[model samples]
Target chain A: MTVHAPSLRQEWQIGPFRKGDIIAGLLGFLVLIGLAAGVGRLFAGMGATTSLTDAYPWGIWIGFDFALIAFSGVGFTIAAVVHILHLHQFQPLLRPSILAGLFGYVAVLMLLLLDLGRPDRFYNFLLFYNMHSPLFEICWCVLLYTTVLVLEVSPDLLANLPWKWPLRLVYRLMTPVTIIGITLSTLHQSTLGTLYLNMPHRLHPLWYTPILPVLFYISSILAGLSLGIIAYKIAMAVRGQKENPAIAIGLGKGIVAVALLYLLIRVGEVIYAGELPLLLTWTPLNRLWLGEILFCSLIPIVLWATPSLRRQPWVHWVAPLSALLGVGMNRFNATLAAQSAPTSAFYSPSLLEWFSTLGIVAAGMLLWYLAVRFVMGSAVKLGYEQH
Target chain B: MTTTQSELSRRDLIKGMGCGVAALMLSSAMVAHPELAHASDGEESDSAWGILIDLTRCTGCQSCALACKETNDRPNPNQTPIGLDTDAYSFVEEKQIENSVGQTESVYVKHQCMNCLHPACVSACTVGALRKTPEGPVVYDADKCIGCRYCQYACPFGVPAYEWENPLGLIHKCQMCADRLAEGESPACVAACPNGALRFGNRKQLLAQAHAQITSNPGRYVDKVYGEYEVGGTSVLYLSPVPFSFLGFPELGDEPNPRYAEAVMKQTPAIALTVASVVTALHLFMQRRQQVNGEATVHITSQKPGDEL
Candidate 1:
């Protein structure tokens, strides 16, 4: 049954200040200061604020961008499930997830701007289209997808507005908008992996394969599913509600299903590349590479694969958390460490690099919190108010 | 105590260390890979220009490296172009090779962008920032560059250098002194070479000359002429006494780097349309199911569906 506003508002439970939120808030302020200083350092042109050299020009910005995009990326996929598949049971998850994706892409653009050598010339990508370059494709997709996200999430705002007839028209045309959104999401998400395709020899053998775009696309899907479980828990915590066991089990099943596919491709690619020897290789870099795969991937798959095990409340957070961390680590390993390993010296983020990274993350958190609390609070209020 | 913790600063310690670590990392790179920092002394010629470096005749004088650096206005002549923050368009590497008789021979090979006949960097540059000249130099236009660094990744020879320290951060690479070639000047390094090791002329003439030399003096040169069939034939040819890999060249076959991405990307439009159409059909099918289910529920309730829905 469609829920009304008054009862839906009562369904939300506002929680008291938790220990985690207080620490996060305090650290947020510190990172804000650091971010300011880092931006100044960047503009002054007086110093190099990052350990980014020619060999490895990317860092936390590019790496964490992939992770965060995955975290909020399940929106269109969820939208497809509810509106297109007519599985109205999951409709409650759709709007909040789309809003999350919108916020995530905005943050991605800002971080990418800062990462560029000439931050001023970023608009040049629109003017100069390199058809062969994946970066070019990603640039276009991000622009188009952000617009798609706005359209997809705007129906929530329309309901509150005075204009009822226009809202009805928008609501009617939503399937096409959703169709566009899903297509764009799949494109840019996979195109992110294409950036690595040009650097075949530079990228490590374990991660490098012709099907990297496929791996990136699949892993993002699984990661998006994994992050959904966590995001729901957070939203519920904010609204002072308890998580249902059924939802937790369902999310776990989703993770296991997608993760198994990812694992098959990952393992198959390793065997095909004949790079299984890298795991046995005694180098510390190889060990770190092997460790990322073992902890983030193999272990989480084990935990989520069993239905009995997934019923536990801990699996709600644990499996998804591990998947997020694993995919994040894989991205960082592939982009940052692998690129730097061939260099004469190792790469690590500098003081300013750490500062800027933390600042951006904190800023994103603050923005997401505000957007959830104010702009899209009604999403979580839907479907269970009267019950 | 909480206020005191808030007042604490982690600034001064990090600022000093940040600079120190950057310096240390960069310095270690120079020490660990001086060869990477080594400047190439290859010659640039106008009208189908190419260089042939005879490894057998060459004495590793490094005058070519020095002269090339001086001509190009490199701030540091000693450093390798491959090193981070280097502006050198040239590089020369010294490597040891073992003969059949177990005699270890030290070989000095000049290294730079191969300036391929069909350069990958040219195709990789979306903005037309990089292009191969008819005169044989693969050049970079800083004004057109967005600093995506695709060229650096695309180059099989690893010749392009990024200006990491600069705020502008444009890519720097060997342009084969196109300006000097335009003025009808021979390349500084080739002109400066005292040992007669470096040969600068038309690419075809250089190739023919290289083949003639190899055929005449089989013992003096390897049976192969590098750059003749490598990565679709580079403008810069090599006649070496030892294998090219011994002098730090990657064993790239005749295939270009752009072909790798092209094969996949060519299928993109078809794949995209197929996926869209398929997903759309599935969506319509699912919505039809919902409509059918709703009709079934209305039949049971016996109150017409419009009022209840």
Candidate 2:
């Protein structure tokens, strides 16, 4: 195979002051502010830094950590689609989605560090063993899967190196690494829901069910496939190339099936649990539950399933974004709203939490774009085109 | 020659990892199951220590709370703590209840850790930082705790309180004076109770005494003991004139809180093996189909650089 050396300096050019630079600049600024906020939180402690109390030990940090992990399912989900299922027509989207997954997990790790009361003991989960704990399993899976992700994305980096052997070795190992990643992801993504199973007393009945693990796992795939469409479109745009419309349409079909199945089980469990009456109550919590179903399941299913609506260019963007938002809301609602605190005290996040959360998100976007513009630009396409 | 050898090695690697992951998960599941199943047993041992609190006794006296602070060496021994916190491991909750004649009356209920026989916090803790000891106290090891606070959600009684004021905080709860028990003294709260409101004894004897008190004192005490069967029996028992729910005790079932979590957790190995097997099977099937369709296997390094999609 003859390798074409990329024209490196041209891709790195930022002096023309384009729109991408401005977004990058803004994200960079937010990241700086977020770093400062994180430092303040670590120094002053949770009591002074955030509105979190004993009544609300977990807040937006956990909410996003859970959501991001779901979103990051793009890594394994897409890997499964292309490598495992041998659907190579979707190959161009793979690298970008995996990169997004890596970034999402990194942001989750950062937020988790901030959320910990003892951030210094972040590695304590590794030292301790508690197989009975859902969190313990999640901790181990996240650590292992992150390593798998680093290896998955390393090919792009290795291709740029003077030595060719590293890339060759990784290429040979891709099939096993991908399978391992999917297996590990299956454990933790489902286990995130299992984390909530312990809190049956605290969680609202409408959202709490014995099948929470199943619900969480399915929604992750829904979110992952939706994000894949977005990632593919964005990656094409970043590369200054036109996207194949067939890819998004194909993925949209997959989303509808998963969304319908998810809706069935999610609502079916509530009925099975005899909590359907709770859904009709229209209490604030009930309304939130209905909203989750509407956005997460109803709207995505309708938007993607209808042929006329699916063909519209705008639906392409709106459908997937709607699914992503619904999944995000579900995670946040599960983490915060569904919980019934022992005390009557309500939680409102502090500015520090808001800033730091935004900053971490900004940092993730910035790194993603930088990689998209520089590191991932031609190498991934070249690798796929050759295959 | 090189391509064939590398392909064979990669397949071998896949098979090896699949088995290794399954084994790891299975071994962890095996190690974890027995301990979890044993922990879920709610029946109290004959030798286990227990606390029996009689709420009908004449006192809203905060002496027990003060003694608790002193014994625990918490900061504010003099201050009356209305709720449990890092500085106050135990507190007396004052409630206004209507008597039989419909007139309001004051009742004080002392609150502390229930030390459940099947403690959800111990099972939910990421680090196994909280443990149910054979001596009947669920002790917390601060050194092992990373302060993830999953325990706070797991405790039905809302017992574990975080030291939110500290930058590096740890969970604080009543350890039922394990040190005092070791020294052959009763818990400080029981020792300091001016009235015999708090009784310390072996669980079996205390349970019998509680039943006897209810039977002997015809209409004086509520027939039900609050902790006798709540969340599979708590070490701390309570007797009151009113239903325990009116005094803000959580209504719980006989099934323990961690039952679902631990049960699901024990299936981790099985889940892993099943997933790995299915995915590997699918991969192999896909590869076989592609070969049968007369398509070449796609490898990153095997093709020319400029091929069309």
- The numbered model that scores best in TM-score is 2
Candidate 2 per-residue lDDT over residues A142-174, each given as its tens digit: 998899999998877887677878887887677
C-alpha RMSD of candidate 1: 13.7
Off by over 4 Å in 2: A1-7, A10-17, A377-385, B1-38, B41-43, B307-309
What TM-score does each of the candidates earn?
Answer: 0.82, 0.95
Per model, how much of the real contact set is kept? 0.28, 0.62
TM-score of 1: 0.82
lDDT of 2 at A91: 85
lDDT of 2 by residue, B239-286 (tens): 898888888888999888888888888888788777877787788788
> How many Å off is the CA of A269 in candidate 1?
2.3
Clashing pairs in 1: A13-A239, B37-B79, B37-B80, B38-B80, B38-B91, B39-B90, B39-B91, B40-B90, B40-B91
Write down the lDDT of every candidate, Cα atoms only: 0.67, 0.85
